[model samples]
Target: MPRARVVINREFCKGCALCTYACPRGILVISRDFNSRGYYPVMVTDEEQCAGCGFCAQVCPDVAIAVYRE
Candidate 1:
């Protein structure tokens, strides 16, 4: 299956976890595993559910989320 293009910049992410809350489709979440900064990393659990609304990107104060439309 083709996947929706979504990218998260872990380095730029301050682990605010706002993306997980902003996603209407419940596609984004905070990882149990920590990133380099010891903050829980955010991720997309289901890409197909993503409507490409860019809510995550918009809510991210750190500009950590990027979504690509296919």
Candidate 2:
């Protein structure tokens, strides 16, 4: 299986948690650091575990996540 890389545009994230819930691998998490918008952004806990399913990107209303398979 190809490894996945998940990138979250922290500046655009709104702390919605939709991506976290959408991730089947449970690799997405809300970070403690706040972006310029004062919102907690999502982070990929383990890119190696990602399935590249794009569920997070699909559910993100802000369109902040990008998933790539390698």
Candidate 3:
């Protein structure tokens, strides 16, 4: 099975947490670190757990999440 790699654009993220809720694998989380705009960004906690479902990217309002399968 192919694995997924998740990338989050910190500059574009607004800390909305929508992607966190959208991830079925529960690999995404809100980071403790802040972005350039002082907003917390979403991060992938475990890449191995990702299923490449692309749910996080689809639900992101800011289009900050990207998922690549390998």
Candidate 4:
């Protein structure tokens, strides 16, 4: 399987969890920590589990996510 890299602009995330719902792999979660904007950020539990499907990026309202295959 191809390895995927998921990069999130933590500061821009609003803890919407849209990506979490969009992920078929179930690798995403909303973090308890707040960002500079005082909003919770979503995090990828494991890049190794990412499928590079780009679903997370597509659902992100902030466009704070990017996915690349490695």
> Residue-wise lDDT of candidate 1 within 19-42, one digit each (tens)?
888888888888788778888878
Which regions of candidate 2 deviate over 4 angstroms?
none
For candidate 1, give the lDDT. Answer: 0.82
lDDT of 3 by residue, 1-70 (tens): 4377888999899999998898888888999999999999998888889999999999999998888997
Task: Please give, for residues 1-70, the per-residue lDDT of candidate 2 as tens digits.
Answer: 5487888899999999998888898989999999998999999888878889999999999999888986
Q: After superposition, how far is residue 27 of candidate 2 from its true place, in Å?
A: 0.5
Checking candidate 3 for backbone clashes, the offending pairs are none
Better of 1 and 4 by lDDT: 4
Per-model RMSD to reference: 1.4, 1.7, 1.7, 1.6
Question: In model 1, which regions exceed 4 Å deviation?
Answer: none
The predicted structure with the larger lDDT, 2 or 4, is: 4
Error of 3 at 56 (Å): 0.3
Highest lDDT: which candidate? 4
Clashes of 1: 0
